[model samples]
Target: MTVIAQLSDIHVRPHGVLYQDAVDSNAMFSAAVDSLNSNRPEPDLVVISGDLTDEGTVDEYQKLRELLARLRQPFVVMPGNHDNRGNLRAAFPDHPWLPGEGSLSFARDVGQLRLVALDTSVPGLHHGELDAASLAWLDDELTVHRDQTVVIFMHHPPFMTGIPYLDIYGLRNADALAMVLARHKNVDRILAGHVHRSMQTRLGNVPVLTCPSTTTQIALRVEADAQPASFLEPPAYMLHRWTGRGQPAVSHLCYVGRFEGPLPFA
Candidate 1:
């Protein structure tokens, strides 16, 4: 089995800075890094879905670089609405898996699993949309890696989360994404972030799982016209265990914290 760990919306800031001038997101993110490092069975790869920096500034990326140095597993990152693609690329010059220009998207193979990352972030926009170039890249990658089990990861989810306020910021061209996804049957799952909450839904038969942030979470207020809000809910991440080809990948939502556990099951 191939194990993939995912952390999203870290929202790291420069030293001595807090997210929204309140929550100490950097500290919280550090805790999450610790949690992943000590995770049992040890994940084979780590994918940070997006929102790596709160302001996408050089200092914030530098801080992120310092924080990521503590992680023991290999990692890759994508961009969200809050991220600056150019800055992110500059932050990690050694990550050749990432392209040097245009839409930070790429595909990699982890054992037999084909991991595809899609760039859905639009510059200077809060909502996301998959452009023709990105969609075409995904289609071609999926076409080339037809025999392997595939999982597509992106910043925005293709399905609505039922929260009106957050839904407004959801992927703008989900129908177009569905069209590309519908053609590929080898795609076992689709992973995404940007909602800052854990959600599950399907887009054209393929299951999509959104990872919770490493810091705060979005309040689950589904009432009509509910305003946008955040909560100090427990930070969390996801672990996807891909068993093999033609089988469903099992996912686990792991909360970051120290708690009583490993007790007798009597």
Candidate 2:
């Protein structure tokens, strides 16, 4: 069995940079880190689906790198819409998702899983696109690895969830992505971050998993007919497991920090 943990939307500090969330990202991220390190049956690999930093600053990335360096397992990090490609590249020089870079993919023949990181961030913007070039590259890569089981990791999701405010910021060139996905049958699951919600759905016959954030939730419910978002809930993270012929895969969703109460369950 191959174990993969998926952590999304880590809004690491150097706060006040994003000006929106105002949440202390480093603290929130640490809660997740502590939980993962102390959990039973540690994961084999970790995948962070972007939003590593709030304002995408070098200092923020520096702090994030230092924190992630504490993990007991190997991990791959990607960039989300709020991430700055240049800062991320320099912070993690060997990182694969750098702009204009060839590709950042890891192949584990032993586990029969090929982990692919797709760069979906649009520079100087808060949306995602699979651009013609990226789509072409993905198509070619899938064709070559037709026999290999694939799990794609990206920052943005291709489908809309009717969350209204969040839905407006979903992927743009989704049709292009959908067309490419249809041609490949080896893809097991398409995972993403950005939305900061634990949203699950199917796209092109494959499951799309969006891991929640470590800072705060965008409030799945509308406060009023007009209000859009709220931070009234605790932060959270996810773990994804893959079970093969010999190994089994399991994914877990964990909430960080303490909440109100147990509510006296029956």
Model 2's TM-score against the true structure:
0.87
Q: Report residue 41 deviation for candidate 1 (angstroms).
A: 1.5
For each candidate in the order shown, give its overall lDDT on alpha carbons.
0.92, 0.77
> Per-residue lDDT of 9-63 in model 2, one digit per residue for the tens?
8877764443254666677787888888976788888888888887788888888
Steric clashes per prediction: 0, 7
- Give the C-alpha miss distance for residue 56 in model 1, angstroms: 0.4
Error of 1 at 85 (Å): 0.8
| Residue 262 in model 1: lDDT | 75
- Each candidate structure's TM-score, on Cα atoms with residue i matched to residue i, is 0.98, 0.87
Pairs of residues at least 3 apart in sequence or in different chains that clash in candidate 1:
none
**Candidate 1, superposed: residue stretches over 4 Å from native:** none
Candidate number achieving the greatest lDDT relative to the actual structure: 1
Lowest lDDT sum, 10 consecutive residues, model 2, at: 101-110
